[model samples]
Target: MGKIKLTINNRVVEAEDGQTVLEVARENGIHIPTLCYLKDLTGTGACRVCQVEIEGARTLCAACVYPVREGLVVKTHSVRALEARKNVVELIVSNHSKDCLSCIRNTNCELQRLCQELGVREDAYAGNKTPSTFDEVSPGIVRDTSKCVLCGRCVAACKKIQGLGILGFMDRGFKTKVGPVYDRSFNDVNCMQCGQCINVCPVGALHEKEEIHDVINAINDPHKHVIVQT
Candidate 1:
């Protein structure tokens, strides 16, 4: 498609007609926060964190999926947009286990980075937390549901890229979750054990099942000098 000219935060910018508002904004160095948007994957617009106000729109639009149009005017960091994004983050944290100090992802988690960047000092929207589940039956991967933000990246990674629909979304609203079909453990499914979901997960919800702890336990055993799995 031909180039389209649009105004982003009072500055004129041009992007491909087919480009999304998020792509155009990022390409021109206009920072718009997002959570459920993974580059190259089809955006679900689930997070609502990338909402931006368009000059002619009645409500804010999700930048990741909103196609850019000529003569369009967008406000990326407007008061309404910032507040809405902040509230969205807060809601995500409401049921989220905020035990970042002990999480494996720690400073590397995308959700943690967003909290820091968005100046989320505390989670204002508190409620009953989602029950936690730690599925370690799979020899290759571990799942901690308490840390999942339901961003759907892992689901997309498994279904879209790997052609394995082993994982999927179920339920709805605050009670929603993503996991192996029928909410069964990963071991029960035909999971490829490829670690694709773990790699794309933005939080500590998924990770490799490391053996470092087993090795350490063997080293501390009083009556053991050497341990062999074979």
Candidate 2:
């Protein structure tokens, strides 16, 4: 198409028309954090982590989905942007169980990592911490809706990349969740157990059911529960 001139983090850059602001920013080493943006996959913009303040826009736009336009001025990490991102992470954390130390992706989880980076000491919202059950029907993966941030990466991966539309975001608002139809188990659907959902999951919400934590605990337990998976 055509070339567009945009200012990213106050630096003028030339980007192709229709190119996502995230793409242009990354190309220029401007880190606009993203979770639901998997290259060559779907850009659902469900996660607001990549949000940037665009001049003349009424609200912050998702950089991964917002197209670059001529003479666009984008602020990647303004005070407003930081607060918005921090609030987004806090909202997700509010619903999630604060068992990060026991989680499989404890140290490696992207959501946890972002929380640390964003400096959110505790969730400020006094909302409901709705408890949900875990889904361990599959062998290689576990689904925990309580920890889901509604990033939609797993949904995109299953539907766009693997061509398996087994996962979807259900319900609305605070009750919204990602799962199969009728909130059924993934195994009940046509899932292939490819583990792409786990790969794309940013939090411990979706992960391989690993006994590594239990294994470590077993060293100190006189009667430890240790069941090896084959």
Candidate 3:
């Protein structure tokens, strides 16, 4: 694609045709907060945290999916854009589990970092949360629907990266969640237990089963020999 010039935050920059506004901004060191977007993965734009102001656009656009054009003007952190991002984070947090203190992905979670960045302090839109499902039947993995942000990263990784497509979104609206078909446990599915879904999950929705304590106990037992398996 040919190079095209665009103005981002009043700074003129050059980008190739077909590049999204978020890509150009990142290439130029302009920060645009995003959720549900991973490099080299298809952009879902499910999360509006990456919304930005675009000149002549009727509404704020998601930078991750908004294509850059010649002479396009974009604002990555305008007041409106920031407010929209904050509101989006707030809504996601409202329904999300509040056990961050004891959660596995507490400090490392993308959603938690976004909340801190967006200054989401209190529950702004608290209401009934989606009925959660906790599936630890799989020996190698645990699935928690409560912490899922429905970013679709795990589903994409399972299909695009692993080529298994074992995981998918179930139901609709407030009843939606990601899991194996028919609400089956991962153990009952064709899942490889490769943990690619866990790697791409932004929150604590998917994680490896806790085997550290078991390993520790075995190591402490004088008669038990712990065999490390890859």
Candidate 4:
């Protein structure tokens, strides 16, 4: 693709013709927040947090996947864009499990960081969240469905890097989920234990199995001895 020149937030910037507005904006020091747009992966544009206002466009566009054209005029932080982004995030938060204090990815979660960035102080549509499901069936990984943002980064990682296709989205709508094929648990599947799913998961949905308490108990037992490695 040839070079394309565009104006972002009043500053002129140049980027490749095929580059999305989000990529160009970030390259030029303009931060467009995202949740489902992982680096080095095709953007799903599922999380509308990266929406930006473009001149002559009737609605805000998803910066993560919206291609930039020559002479394009875009506003990365316009009032309308902010409100729409905030609303999208709020809906996600409402349907999400808000137990960040005790969650595994508390301080390191992308959703939490985005909420803070957008100044979301309270839930605008709180209700019964989806039923929580905790599955530690895998010896090396834990699956927490409640914390999943449905971003599909883990699914992408498994398919692209591992090539195992061990996980995928199941069911539909509010009941949708990512898991092993045929609704089987990871313990029952041929999961390779590569931990790629844990690595790509943006929230607390996937993580290393927490066996610290078991180790501590074994250490304190009179007849038991535990060896540790870091």
lDDT, each prediction = 0.89, 0.84, 0.92, 0.87
lDDT of 2 at 213: 75
Write one digit per residue (lDDT tens) for candidate 2, span 1-230: 98879898789999999899999999999988776678887677877888889999999999999999899999999999989988888877788887887787888888877888889897687678765758898767789887887888888889888987889878888778888777888778888889898888888888887867767888668787666567
Candidate 4 TM-score to native: 0.92
User: What CA root-mean-square deviation does each model show from the true structure?
Assistant: 2.7, 4.2, 1.1, 1.8
User: What lDDT, from 0 to 1, does candidate 3 have?
Assistant: 0.92
- Candidate 3 stretches with Cα past 4 Å from truth are none
In order of lDDT, best first, we have 3, 1, 4, 2
Clashing pairs in 2: none
Ranking by TM-score: 3, 4, 1, 2
The true-versus-predicted C-alpha distance at residue 36 of model 2, in Å, is 2.2
Give one digit per residue, the lDDT tens place, for model 3 in 74-160: 999999999999999998888899789989998999998998898999999999999998999877999998999999999999999
Tens digit per residue, CA lDDT, model 1, 1-230:
79879999999999998999999999999999888899987588988989999998999999999999999999999999988888889888888888889888998988888888777888697779876677999879998888889989998899889998888888877678889976788898999799999989989999998898888998899988975776
The 10 consecutive residues of candidate 1 with the worst lDDT sum are 125-134
Which predicted model would earn the best lDDT?
Answer: 3
Steric clash pairs (candidate 4): none
For candidate 4, write residues 67-121 as lDDT tens digits: 9999999999999999998898898888888888999999999889988999888
The lDDT, on a scale of 0 to 1, for candidate 4 is 0.87
lDDT score, candidate 2:
0.84
Q: Which 10 consecutive residues of model 4 have the lowest summed lDDT?
A: 129-138
